[model samples]
Target chain A: MTVLSDIGHLLLTADLWHAALAAAVLLLLPALGGVISERSGVVNIAMEGMMLTGAFFAVAADLILHDPWLSALVAMVAGGLMALIHAVVSIRFRADQIVSGIAINIFATGITVFLINRFYGLQDVGHLPPSELLPNLQIPLLDQIPFLGRVLFQQNVIVYVALILLLLVHVLLFRTRLGLRIRAVGEHPEAADTAGINVYRLRYGAVISSGLLSGLSGAFLAIGISNTFVPNMTDGRGYIALAAMIFGKWTPFGAFIACLIFGLGQAIYDNNSIIHVSQYLLSMLPYILTLVVLAGVVGRSQPPAADGIPYAPGTE
Target chain B: MAASSTAAAGRPAPPLAASLRRAGRAVAVPAGSVVFAFLMGAVIVAVTGGNPFAAYQALICGGFGLLCSGGENAGLQVSNTIVFLTPLIMAGVAVALPFRAGLFNIGAEGQLIVGAIACTTVGIHFAAAPAPVLLPAVLLAGMAAGAAWAGIVGVLKALTGAHEVVTTIMLNYIAQWLLRFLIIGGPLQLHNGFSVSSPIGAGAHLSTLLPHDDKLIVFGLPASVYRVHVGLLIALLAAGTYAFLLWRSSFGYEVRAVGQSQKAARYAGMSVRRTIILTMLISGAFAGLAGAVQIAAVDHNLTDKYFSDTTGFDAIAVALLGLGTATGIVFAAILFGALHGGGAVMQSDAGISGNLVYVLQALILFSIAANFLRTLKLRLPAVGRAAGTPAAEAPAGALAGESATALADDEGLA
Candidate 1:
């Protein structure tokens, strides 16, 4: 009962909601990435690796260049390169996408640590100065609004960017001709190929785009939310994003809602000082919730029809 | 009939040649993958301004106890490799069995963790029992716990048509958090120790192969320095059991039939759902046995080291590289065990990060999955097109087909 009261009181505070939105945005970026990649018929379980790679390069670049924007760009490129390996192996060579994804994850973990050892002599990556970190934007007048202002207006620049990207992805995936073609290709590549859609080109583009989004999320995590890059700093956020994608049934808006739920859990865990619950047990909630969703309590969540199948031309 | 008889007599030489070709092709892809990975690893090391040769030399010295420049003992190193590979053999069987059923068991890590937890709980509770009673109790407890953990996945998959890959991933995280909860502040925590459980009783320990005696010296070191335990024999027995279960049992036939085509299996009067559930139960039991043995033979308690344990993940590569055969799995386990043993030496002696092992592992996975050598048209004379295709295609095909069938079933339900 005390725990319930604690959570209830915490929910009413603007600070909790503010932190929740920020965390949700963090998960939202990769969840959106997952949505794009899986919708293109490529099973992308590699966002965790891509995000880790992005986070490492982002911190590394920021240390060298001292510019957050440039560092973010470097991060995206690094993530895209990792994804390119996955795309080439799974899409071009017709390999198992899951195995390729696993390889990407393992490779990212190894390369990042190996680079840290080479550059920093087995020491920690030094923290960035406040001036070098991504700035928080205070929307002028809107910031004066009571509770919603702190929750929505005065937030990290990346949070705003992510919210905008969320809208753009929603519109792009459902409201455009390109979106239709992506869905068609995912549903039936052979039929789409017959319809003159370049299935390979679309899949490659979708996969790379997922990497870019995941990279941006990683940059936000390393440079905005935190100042230094710890080993495995992303922890399992990328995987949580995967859960969000599935919980939302692969739609951008659906995934966003799922992210908010998981993000709330993260926010609550962060405020564990007041809540009388084990943080570790609290941490398991997202995965448990996802499992519940998968168990059909939330209705069946179907994937793209041709997802995970290698596109062999002229095959049935 | 006359022509057929003449051809058979004339082509008598072809039988021996064909068998040789068959054996050659079996060894080619996995060998090629390892070579490709090592070459790529060398390139990565060189590009990063490190001496690849020095690093590899240290690795070889550490793994096989040869060409040592660091004054490490050859006998001790071999013992270390054996210890490292012991659990991997069982875990490899865990992954391999599920693959034979067309189910990807990515939750081996989770299963192993719960098994460790259960084994610790039982061993601690039964501290006063004799070795004859406590030893088997702890191991069976671990197996039961692991099976129950994985049974949730099997039930969901069988009833709801949920994809095993996604469910397994979720379960892995859940088990990780559960383990943390158990040891940190839960009942399993030791009195004064941090992030560790109390050691099990002496009766629960799986005695080392060598007598624990500081006075006895072998190969210029105390016999106690060698940590190789009786788990090696258990692991080998487990491998033999896996082979027998997979090749000679009626259950194995059902599993393979379901793996080949679920619809055909269902048409042939086998319950696909039951086989799916049973395969996961058995698979999880193997993984659980791995954890129980590690606790009994090596660690003897739940420790922070288990947090970063990669034995289950390494088993995936072992199963793949071994081509899901008992002998192949043993050989692959040895290679991986050697790499792990060598990694520490490489880090200390060559000033290279031990993470290079993981990089090499990832490269091997990429090469194997993509069949890069085959794609480059570097086919060996023994690898006929048909023979090479099945080995590379089976895993991918089975996974894709299983999910497609699951999706179709879901649509019918809807």
Candidate 2:
């Protein structure tokens, strides 16, 4: 009984809610990134790198701008810039999309480490001042509510923004003409192009959107839970987001739920038995989750017909 | 990875003559991709802060300079590269093989771990045997273990219609956890004060090669001590044999047929399910050999990081670069080996992080992927794909007589 109550107390803590909020943003971003990028018939697998890139820029921006909101925007712009690199290489150079995505991840990982070492002159940097930290927006009446308030209301702007992005992605993908064109491109780029849709334009749009959402996700990582930045901080969360996207069959809502579950899985696992579990086993949570999700959605995931396939003019 | 059927909606197969043409065309592109890949690598080195000439020299020196110095260190360097490449080559081939059949096997890391666990078990318990026999037994045991690991993925793919990618990945974690549990608790327990390593038996070790000259000279100076073994020969033999199997056998033909047109293959009486499972098993067996070699030659015991890093995921890149041919995979693996070998030197000499090599590798992969996407005007970056394009990639750059860009399909082949 004591152990059970202890577990309960731990679960209901402020830190747990923060972790949950953190996890939810990560899960939702990639799927939204996918949909937005799918507008051009591409699925950005470099979300990992973009998220990492954003994390770095978010801290850098916060350090310079001295405003958290400005820092968040900087993260988005940085992610977009990273996505732009991907876009040029993949769209123009006709590189392999998956490989291109991997390059982004690798380069981002390297550059971040290099810059951090140069800037901080150490293995890691200390946290920014409280003014630079994202303040929680607690609802007045909702604060009176017990568990619900803790879980939902008292998060930084990024958390609330994450929820808004989820709905926005769903609406953009399912309800709007822009979404239709994007889906069409993903489903059949050739047909979409033939129907007078500018395929390159769509792809550019998608890559840009991937940058934006992934940027937000990155911001959430640096400021939402912890007020410090670290290299490889996003770690494999981006890949897990990819898994969640796949598990959700590319639906924004589905991905949100999957992300939440993964975050919870991380939260529970992180708090509950990480130490007790084998270090190797514990480290492999995201990959395992990825595999499970992949398996679950395999055969069912009808990725846009042209998801990784680039668009060409004369080719069949 | 869309499902391919041997008998799409019901139709007979095409003429054998066309199959011959496909066989020829299939051989051509990967050959081209290889030369093209090398050229790209050269270009990338120039674009970075380093000279390609110096980097290449460093790479060549790093890989073979040890050998030129004479006796043991050279042999050791050779063997280490080969030993490392052995698993990479096997995993590369494993991935590439299924790829020809239009399948993706991204679970090589997991599968390799499972195989290693089994190999480690052999190293820990089995004693009282000579080097040759014990090593062979361990190798076989590793093969069986790895094969079973791949087989699990195969079975899942077959029965539940699950994607091999997901199943194999999940299985990798399970295998990893299970091995750790077994190693910590029961039969293979290290039981040695918090160390997560098993006590490997001396008898179950690889015989020393270059017994006399274990330490060799580098650049006219005798420096660096290491040993070499028979693993290099094994790696070469494995690559050659895989090449033979891919091009010479009826099974190879069936695999190609299924890959090119599953429905047609099915109409022609090919067993899609069996092939899928068998392909994964073959991949596993090869991976197991890699594990055995790593144990016998390098680490000599089951340790933690042994299961993790090695960039087994990058083997997919090697396979893609190789375009699924044995010789291509061998060269690609060697290239990766050299890259890894030179990474430390590059970082030390240039004051760049060893990860710069990764960045360069990623650049090369993404650029090629970018080249592929140009056709579709869809651009993205390959962060560190190292290599990409399972199909048509090798067709252009790998084969001897033919040449083409492997990046075509990755960009907009669909």
Best candidate (score: lDDT): 1
> What are the RMSDs of all candidates, in order?
3.2, 8.5
Q: Write model 1 residue lDDT over B376-408, tens digit each, in one string.
A: 563455643333332234454477776545535
Cα-lDDT of candidate 1: 0.88
Q: Tens digits of per-residue lDDT for model 2 on A140-236? A: 8986677777788876767788788788888988999988888888777778888999878878878988988898788878866668888679856
Q: Quote the positional error of residue B334 for candidate 2 in Å.
A: 2.2
DockQ of each: 0.66, 0.36
Q: Which 10 consecutive positions of candidate 1 chain B have the poorest summed lDDT?
A: B383-392
Error of 1 at B72 (Å): 0.9
Candidate 1 residue-wise lDDT at B109: 88
Candidate 1 residue runs with Cα over 4 Å from true position: A272-274, B1-13, B378-392, B404-414
Per-residue lDDT of candidate 2, residues B1-414 (tens digit) = 111232453554465754665665554444444445556656645554546665555555556544231232344455455545656777777677767666666667766676667767777777666666777788888789888888877766655455554466456556666666666554566675543667557766765454534266643434334444567777677778677767798777877766665556666777766776787788778777777777776677776665445455667778776756787688778877766766555444443445555655565565444444323332235433323343234331221111011112222322
Return the DockQ of model 1.
0.66
Model 2 has a DockQ score of 0.36
Assign candidate 2 its CAPRI class: acceptable
